[model samples]
Target: MSYVALYRTYRPKYFKDVFGQKVIVQTLQNALLHEKFAHAYIFSGPRGTGKTSIAKIVAKALNCEKAPTAEPCGECAVCLGIDKSSVSDVIEIDAASNNGVDEIRDLRDKVKYAPSVGKYKVYIIDEVHMLTQAAFNALLKTLEEPPKYVVFILATTEVHKVPATILSRCQRFDFKNIDTADIEANIKKIVNKERLKISNEAINAIAITSEGGMRDALSLLDQVVSFTKDEISEEDVYKVSGGLSRRFISELLQTIYQKQPQKALDFLNQVLQDGKDISRMVSDIILALRDVLLDKIREDKKYPELNGLTPPLIYAYLDILNELQQSLKYTTSKRAYLELAIIKMMNHQSIEYVELNQKIDALQKEMHNLETRLRSEVQVKQVESSKNIKVQSKSNLKPLVTVSEISEILNQGDREKKNLLKIGWPSLADYEVPQLRGVAKLLHEGSLEAVGANRMLLVYDDIITAQNMLKKETKEKVLKIINSKKQLIDDYTVLLKADWMILKDDYAYQYNAGISKPKLKEIDLHLYEQDEDSIQEVKLEEDPLVEFAKASFGENLVKVEE
Candidate 1:
């Protein structure tokens, strides 16, 4: 009983003493110094952010016999009475208990009368927003025109809910939540002031747990002080508050970074087995990752907790968490989330999360730069293909084009298909072709040879690929799309022809370092590398065929028999 709560004991007695609302406090101080106090005042902000505290300070300042000033002399008789809650004229009404229209009417009647003892009759209504609409209506007239001796000080957490009619008649002052640094410093001040021995880490835990609320921070400190004798340790602080453990989160993220899903899963299992809720773990991972993101972003702050790791490392850890969050919806398991997150973390090229972010960002910017260049190159290729299409319209009277020309027309397709399937396939599906045209993923590659009108010998390679593409679901999809029956040509097709062998791997052809990639790049570069050296220098010829004839002469070599 001897020890009062830190927030309560440390509650500001004067305007200058109120924390984190300098603007409001200064304005109040100026008002008091000028003897320009408002009839009714509203103080609003988040809880534990000094709304009510400031209101009480204002009440004491106006009524304090020491003279109206921002820094009220706390030793004054009026200030002492307000502090002791024994002031007769200064009524502190809990609107929560007295929220009816009758209460407002009764209060309204009383406001018309003069203060019994003091110069001003101050009404400090906490949670003033709880007043019924009827109560507010009854209070509005009294709020708009109170006697010189009466002052109304309303405090609420929800200023948004307060009626405009009530707000218009009163002076509004808003309070702000304390910052993390301020909270930490205040805790340190208290520890030093009280001669209590607590670790810096414990002080930090209290600060972080407070989350920018001074009252909450004080409460945490109070609990820690009560739990253990005078000296509170960091471990005790953490146990008292089940906040997300940063060490555990970092370790889980490291496993994710390793991409060892099995190991990551095992680690996740341990967390779950530790009696931690998956949702809580997932939420903590997100917050810790958020802190990681903050650490990455607030590079200028040089936060002590974010020391050692660079911005890039923080970002890499953040990126891992971001990836984990993406896959969270697929499975509700905490283990799964942790595993996926850690696995992603493992894949990061940079071991440091901050390094990964910067590198990732740099690489992303570079990739974007590359993409812009690639798109410009592609657009140039597309324009060239468009020109060639017009050119081919005149000189080429042929229905079926050559393999290289087939490659040329494919430039107009979406970048994905062009990059994925490549113009390896001949014609559009259901396109009227010479039967050889539709079989390009095969025919041009020597999988099919023309024998007669509609018959062709399906070669072994084409047979294999077609077999894979025509698998159960694929066959269903193909049958739905093409409306075709397989004409088994070779012994290979007859023996092993169930599904079409569409290569799952886009670079599977390039899997052989020596063979596959070079050929693919050769083709990609060959087809894509068509444009005037200086696009601005090009003169438009009447016949588009002239440009193509020149380009063909350059590299494309349109394979026109003319």
Candidate 2:
């Protein structure tokens, strides 16, 4: 007799023998025990996850001579018949080949007949998603309301392709990929039972390569056992599976961390010479990086050579390798792509450092330009002071508007007018009126804080901006511009932000304390004005350095000091 593969030889006979699907086993057993099982059921998951195997076990349990048992009696004639696929009542259909309306129509017609030798006739359809629309439509009605003695078990790896109409009628069970630990334990049990001479490292390599598939693991084990007569080793597994050993992967990563491009390339060339797959090598490296990342996050010390690497660096390495892995699929020059990825990983830090240095240089140039502009402004102010012009010092500057005026405006502030003026403030920066250009520039430097009747208050971040806005010529031009816009403001004044905040707080305290408004006073507004000649019109020229700073960083991040 031909040798049976391990997967088939160790195929689960009873629910208890099924591995890595405890929840599914228990649920099906309970459903069978209570006799409340659905007439139609769908099993969906990855391949080799026991979807069809469990379906067959369910058929055996339903048809076992001792009826309604959770665990089937494999010795019964009906159980033995179903196991051998000799039972006429249990039919397993491969939907990939028989997916058509004619086949489903035949099934619909045959459902009316009674079971041949068992109490229930079970129909197990594999890869049910392969069925065409017409076939699904033909099966829908019968699947929803099948005969009492008929059971339909639909299994598919890609459940998304299955129609909602067909899915809605059946009870769906989603099988998960078997865990690596569980797969490892199962492989060990098989090895011990078969008396196969295999090392633990070989078993682990098989389990990891399987990627959570039990059948794949067992199939790999069978191949490895056939290849080697002596005790199997990890090297044997890697050689057979076209995978890089973990030690080689660790050494490659260490060379990368040490920034030894030559050494890393040497390792790559060696692997290629050994006939290992380039894409598989990249995948192994990514997996090794993943392990290092987890160790770093968990504060564990597993890879000492990788101890110098940071999480962010590992993440970047993974990103580069992952991109290379994707690009390898469509490219013929796989070696060139892998070489380029290794070089990128080696120079990642240097590249990031260069970029950071460039940013710092730009910021230094901006600061120097700012300092030069401030010094020039200081010189102009000094020249004005020599002419005996009354220029208020920033620290000792007084508010242009009196406390009484502020109190009167705040007490009777118009919410609607203030909101309107606030909305229109941004437009002043791009004003087209030539005569009001300087006024627009000054107003744009400050913000409209309050509006009362025909009076307004503007606040600025610095004393220089407030003083310039309060200059006699700037204020007159502003009034003319406002009148042109039909705003008709009687007067406006400027104050520093710090002073405004204090005044605002005091006013709020008085209002909340129910204090009455102060008596109105007709004070001379000329006291607040500065000589027109002393405060020159702000130039409209755009500073290229400032613009560059704004463009390099952003407008919101760049601030003009003066």
Candidate 3:
């Protein structure tokens, strides 16, 4: 004789009583009518979407005294017993608490017995995703091949957690969120049937808050109904649910649209002072802005307050409010964030100002690109002119010291051995110690090819990596690390590995073996003797005529007897 909750009191006993799941209901009934019912069923979907409810309904339909009928006779003892949870054959287990291997083994043992009362025994396990791996594994064999008269129904909010093996053996049904219109219609029916006086606005508010869950809609309606004896207004729903009213949302948006920043802030402060939730206020504002956007798109003047505002401006308002809604989760000063969000929304520049700024930015970027192109063209012209002049002046200019002369000087003087430059060549690559290993990796492509007191030549396989070393910061770091213990060298000349190879071959051929063989200096030839495999062979067939002309013209053209 106690009052029953609305959700339980009005629970769907027949398939026709359920809403928003016509496909599932039709499919289950067709399977039942043809005697093609699956032995194992898995119901998976979001919480409170009638997954468990549908499973129970299927149980009632299967074991009805009418025998394999799609509709259960609620008057029968078997149907009543299942509805009241008193049936021995129709068992409902909460998997959250009983999810263990031992519990599953006990279940497997009990599944073999025939139904004591009904023709079929049904087991409904809720939250089956909570079952441990061992429990699932133990239940797999029995689920795949249960007794002929036994049926297993598994329900879970997360289907991904269930093993594929169990899923393969069961017929899966996906429950969808109840549509808002469906929820609204269903609530209206309950209101009418209960003979309660509730406004349309209050019913809409409950539907929106339910978020596609029918049970939630009923519970919220029940809560609102309990507090009021007379007609339930929108204010009662907002007050009970800690939500904001449309008037508050409308006034706040009006101040923002009119660009009255201080007035907007004051209004928000007043809402907080009256105990309105910050998050709820933001959500309500978002919904109002969405309606404004819809009206803007439709070109309908449903909301007179949004008549003057453009679509972009309304969208900007929505973006700010939504962003603040997210940022409030991490902050303690919700009121402060909300106020700042309103001021930002109000202070946003008019459409004309925003477009003008965008135009200016685009023009500046174009001008910068033009300047860069002109500067690069000027540098290219300068380089070409310099190269032409060098070609014309090559007959007049002569090296102050030739390679032969340098070789003599290097071989004759004991300074070649005593110079710290020679000793530093071997350790330069290794100098990129662990601390500077990143720079060292870049340097490894090149080695210390030639060393002198004033300068040294380093070769790198990749030109880009070599150029990276030529950067001012990179040059400083390399020199600092190299001379950290002792400053043996002052400056460096970074060269491509190919260029270094050419220079070495030319020096060796002119002074040691190829074109002009000069008298040998007892230099430490060991320092320059390259591995035969490392030396690249040059064939006359591969040379272009210009290179042949240079080689034939002698190292210098017009050899004059002075």
Q: Which of candidates 2 and 3 is the stronger one according to lDDT? A: 2
Weakest 10 consecutive residues, lDDT, candidate 1? 491-500
Instruction: Give the Å error, residue 383, model 3.
Output: 62
Q: List the residue pairs that clash in candidate 2.
A: none
Candidate 1 vs candidate 3: the TM-score winner is 3
Question: How would you encode candidate 3's per-residue C-alpha lDDT over 1-562 as one tens digit per residue?
Answer: 9988888888899998898889989999999888899999999988778888888888888889996888888889999999998889988889999999999999999999999888889999999999999999999999999999999999999999999999999999999989889888988999889999999989988888887888988998899999898899888888788787777777877887677888888887776777888898888888777787777667654466766666667767777877898999999999889888877876656534654666788899998886555433433332223322122232333322234533333233334433555455456556546777666556555676555545556665543465567676777777776677776556565654444444566566665654453443322111121234443443323213233335556646633343
Model 1, 283-384: lDDT tens digits are 666666567656655655423343444545556666666666666667766465665556556554555445556677889999888655554444344334
| Model 2, residue 2: C-alpha shift (Å) | 0.4
Model 2: per-residue Cα lDDT over 426-486, one tens digit each: 8888889887887787788787888887788887765456667777787788888777767
* Every candidate's lDDT: 0.62, 0.82, 0.74
